[model samples]
Target: MISTVVWGTGNVGRAAIRAVDAHPALKLTAVLVHNPDKVGRDAGQLCGLTHELGITATDDIDAVLAAGPTAVVYAASGDIRPDEALADITRAISAGAVVVTPALYPLYDQRNAPPEFRDPVLAAVADGGGSLFVSGVDPGWGNDVLPLLISGLGTTIDAIRCQEIFDYSTYDQEDSVRYLVGMGQPMDYQPLMLVETVPTMVWGGQIRLMARALGVQLDEIRETSDRRPLDATVSTRTMGEFAAGTQGAVRFEVQGIVQGEPRIVIEHVTRIHPSCAPDWPAPPGGGDGAHRVVIEGRPRIEVTVEATDEGENRSAGGNATAVGRLVGAIDWLVGAEPGLYDALDIPLRPAVGKLGRKQS
Candidate 1:
C-alpha cells in the first residue's frame, strides 16, 4: 500500500483523512495540524470518523516526512496561510513526497494569481524531484472539468459557461458566509464584495484551464459580480448563524479571449436570496441541494447534480465526491510524471465508484 500523510485538520483535511482511510490501495500514515488543540488527537475523531482509522494528528512535518510516506495531501486554509501551505508542500516535495492540495488560491486561475506564489510552487516541485496537483469541486471540477467534458462533444464551440447554485443555509456560517455572501451588519457593508481580487482567484484558473483544453488562447479575461437580498431568514442551527432575509447573492463571470477575440465565457453564481431560483426551480430531490450545468453551442449538454443529504450535512455529498477523487488518484499521483497538474491533465476514468460514477 502507498503510505500517505494529510496536512491540516479543517473540513477538507478531515474529509481527505476519511478518504485515505477507506481506500484499499492507500494508507493514512499521519495527519499534520497547526492547531495546538488538535495535535495528538485521533485523526478519525477529528473528522467525526471515530473508530475508523487510529492515526494521530501532529504538528511536526519533518517527523511525518521521516516516516517514509510517499505522498502528502495539503488541505490547509487558502485564505490565511496559503503561502505557508505552499511552503509546506515545498518541504514535503523536497523530502520526496508527491503533493496534492485543495487550497483555494494558487493558480486555479492563472490570470488572477500573483507570480510570487505561482512561480515558486512550480520551481519547488521541480527542485524536489516530486510532483504536485490541486483540485476541489468548484475550481477543480464544476468549472474546469465540466466545461472540458462538454467540449469533448463539440466540433466547434462559441462559448462555454458553467454554474453552481445551491442553498447556503446549511453551510458553516463563520467559515463560508462572509466569503460567499458577505454577511456582517448591513447587507451592503461589503458592497461589490464578491468582485474583490480574492474571490476571483478561485474561479479564474478554471476558466484558463477550460480555454487551454479547448485549444483557445485567451488574450484577456474580465470578471463581474452581482448580489441581492432574500425575502425570509435563512438559518443554520448547527452553525448558529442566520440572515434576517437573504442577505445577498454573488455571481462571477469571466470572459475569455483568443487572439484579441472573445472565445468562451464562464460564470459562477452564489446567492443568499431565494428569488434567484424563479425560472430554474430548485431541485426538490431533498438534501442540501443540487446544481445544474447547461452548456450552449455545438453538442449542447444540460445536466443537474442533486445533493443526497440534508441540512448542515449537505456539504458531505460534495466533500465525499472530492475525497473519493483524491483518494482514487493516490497511485497515479505518487508514481506519474512530476510537475503541477490539474484535473484536465489526468484522465477521468478509474475514479472510485463510491460516490457514484460520472455521467456520460
Candidate 2:
C-alpha cells in the first residue's frame, strides 16, 4: 500500500480524505488543515464521515513531510494563493513524495506550461526523485479525456466543444462567488476570474492538450466573454443577496484555432442564480451543474455528466470526481519513474477492485 498524506481540509480536501480511506491500495497517513479548530480532529469525522479513520488532522507541514509519505494529495485551494500552493507542492515533491493535485492550472499541460511555473516543479522532481500531476474537472477530464473519448464515435469532426454549465447559488464558496466572480457586485465590477487573458491562463491549457492529442497544429488561441445582469435582486440560501443589475451570469470560451478556425473550444456558462441567464446554456439534467462535451461532426455526439454529493451539492459532487481521478493514480505513480505528469500521461483507470467495498 502507498502511504499517503492529504493536505488541506476544505471543499476539495474533505472529499480527498474519504477517497483515500476507501481506496484499497492506498493507506491514509496524515491530514493537514489550516483551521486551528480542525487540528487534532479525527480524519474521517473532520470530513463528515461517521466512522473514525484512526488518523488525526494537524497543521504542521513539517511533520507531514518528515514521515516520508510515498504520495501526497495536495487538495488545498490555489485560486487565491497559487504561489503558496506551488511552494507547498514543491516542498512535498522535494521530500520524495509523489504529488497529485487540482491546484496548479499551468501544470495541467506541464509541457507548454510557463517556464516560471514548470521550471521549479521540474527541479523538485529532479531533486528528490518524485512525480507531480496537476489537474481538475474542466482542465482535468471535461476538456481532455471525456471529449477525446466521445470524439472517437465521430467520423468527420468539425469542432470539439467542452462546456461546464453551473448554478452557483448553492455553492459554498461565498468569497469566490461574490468578489472573485463579481456575482453580487455591481455590473461594472469585473471579477478577477473573467478578466482579459485570465480565461486563457486557466482553460487554455486544456485546448492545447486536446489539439496535441488529435495531432493538429494550433495557429493560436482566443477568448470571447459575455456577462448578464440579474433582472432583479435575488436572495440565495447560502449567499445572502444579489442586487438587481449586478453581475449575474458569465459565459466565456477559450478556443484553440487550427487553420485560422477554432477547432477546439472550452466554454463555461456560470450563473450566480438560476434566473440570471435563461438564454445561456444550462445544466442538461436540470441539476445544480454539469460538465458537457459536444462533438460537432457527422454524428454530432453530445455527453453530459452531472455529479452531486453532500446532499445534492453539485460543487461537492464535482470535487469528488476530481479526487477520484487524482487519488486513483497514486498506486500507478508510486511504481513509475519520478517526473512531472499531465492528463495525457495518466489513464482514466476503472475501479477494478472496488466493486464490493464497504462505505467509509
Candidate 3:
C-alpha cells in the first residue's frame, strides 16, 4: 500500500481523508492542518466519520515529511493564499513526496502553465525525484476527460460545451460565495473571479488543452458574463441574509475560437437563489447541481453528472470527486518518474481502481 498524507482540513481536505481511508491500495498516514484547534484531532472527526483513523492532524510539516510518506494530497485552498500553497506543494515535492492537488490553478494544463510557477515545480521534481499532478472540477475531468469522451460517440463534431450549473445557497463557503464570487453583493461590485483576464488566467488553459486534444488551433479565447440581482430578501441555511437587489446569480462563458468560430466552450450558471434566474439552464429535476457536457454534432450527445455527499449535499459531492481524483492518483504517481503532469497526461481509469470496494 502507498502510505499517504492529506494536507489541509477544509472542504477538499475532509473529503481527501475519507477517500484515503476507504481506498484499498492507500494507507492513511497523517493529516496536516494550519488551524491550531484542528491540531491533534482525529482525521475521522474532521471528516465526520463515526470512527477514528489512527492518524492525527499535525502542524509540523517537517516532521511529517521526515516520516517518509510516499504521496501527499495537497487539498489546501490556493484560492486566497496561492503563494503559500505553492510554497507548501513545492516543499513537499522537494522533500520527495509525490504531490497531487486542485490548488495550483495554472498547472491544470501544464503545457500552457506560466514559467514562473512551472519552473520551480520542475526543478523540485528533478532534485527530489517526486511527481506532481494538478487538476479539479471545472478545469479537471469536467472539461478535459468528460467532453472529449462524449465527443467520441458522435459521428461528426461541430462544438463541445461543458457546463456547471448550481445553486450556491447550500454551499457553505461564505468567503468564496460572498466575496470572491461577488454573490449577495451589490450589482456594481466586481468579483475578483470574473474580473478581466482572471477568468482566462484560471480557465483559459482548459480551452487550450481541449483544442490541442481535438487537434484544432484556437484563434482566440474570449470571456463573457452576466449577473442578476435577488428580487427579494432571502435567507440561506448556512450563509444567512441576502437582501433584495444584491447580486444573486451569475452566468459566464469562456469560449475557444477555432477558425473564427467558438467551438470549445466552458460555461457556468451559479445562483444564490433558485428564483433568481428562471430562464437560465438548470439542473434536471430542479436538483441542486450537475456537471454537463453537450456535444453539438452528429448524434448530438448530452451528458449530465450529479453527485451527493453523506447528507445529499451536491457541493460536498463535487468536492469528494475532486478529492478522489487526486487521492486515487497516488499509486500511479508513486510508480511514475518524477515530473509535473496535467490531466491530459494522466489516465482516468487507474484513478478508479480500489474505489468503492471493500478494503483488503
lDDT of 3 at 143: 77
Single out the weakest 10-residue window by summed lDDT for candidate 2: 134-143
Rank by lDDT, highest first: 2, 3, 1
Off by over 4 Å in 1: 109-114, 191-193, 257-263, 272-287, 307-312, 352-360
Per-residue lDDT of candidate 3, residues 1-360 (tens digit):
898999988888888899999887889999999999999999999988888887889999999999888899998899888889889998999989999999888888898889988999998998888889998754278878889888889999999999999889898779999999999899999999999888887888888989988899999999999999999999999999999999999999999999898899999999998999999999998878889999998989999998898689887888888777777778878888899998778878664555456532
lDDT of each: 0.65, 0.89, 0.88
Per-residue alpha-carbon lDDT of model 2 for 1-360, expressed as tens digits? 889999988888898999998899999999999999999999989887889989989999998899899999998888888899999999999999999999998888899999989999999999988999888744378878889888889999999999889888988779988888888888888799988898888888888888889999999999998999999999998888899998999998999999999889998999988888898898865678998899998999988898987888997888889888899889989988999998899989999779999875
Give lDDT: candidate 1, residue 221.
71
State the weakest 10-residue window (summed lDDT) of model 1.
Answer: 351-360
For all predicted structures, in order, the TM-scores are 0.85, 0.97, 0.97
Quick one: how many clashes does candidate 3 have? 0
- Kindly list the per-residue Cα lDDT of model 1 for residues 290-350, writing each as its tens digit: 5556667666777776544323465556665665566666678877877766676666655
Error of 3 at 165 (Å): 0.6
> Best candidate, TM-score-wise?
2
Candidate 3 lands at a TM-score of 0.97
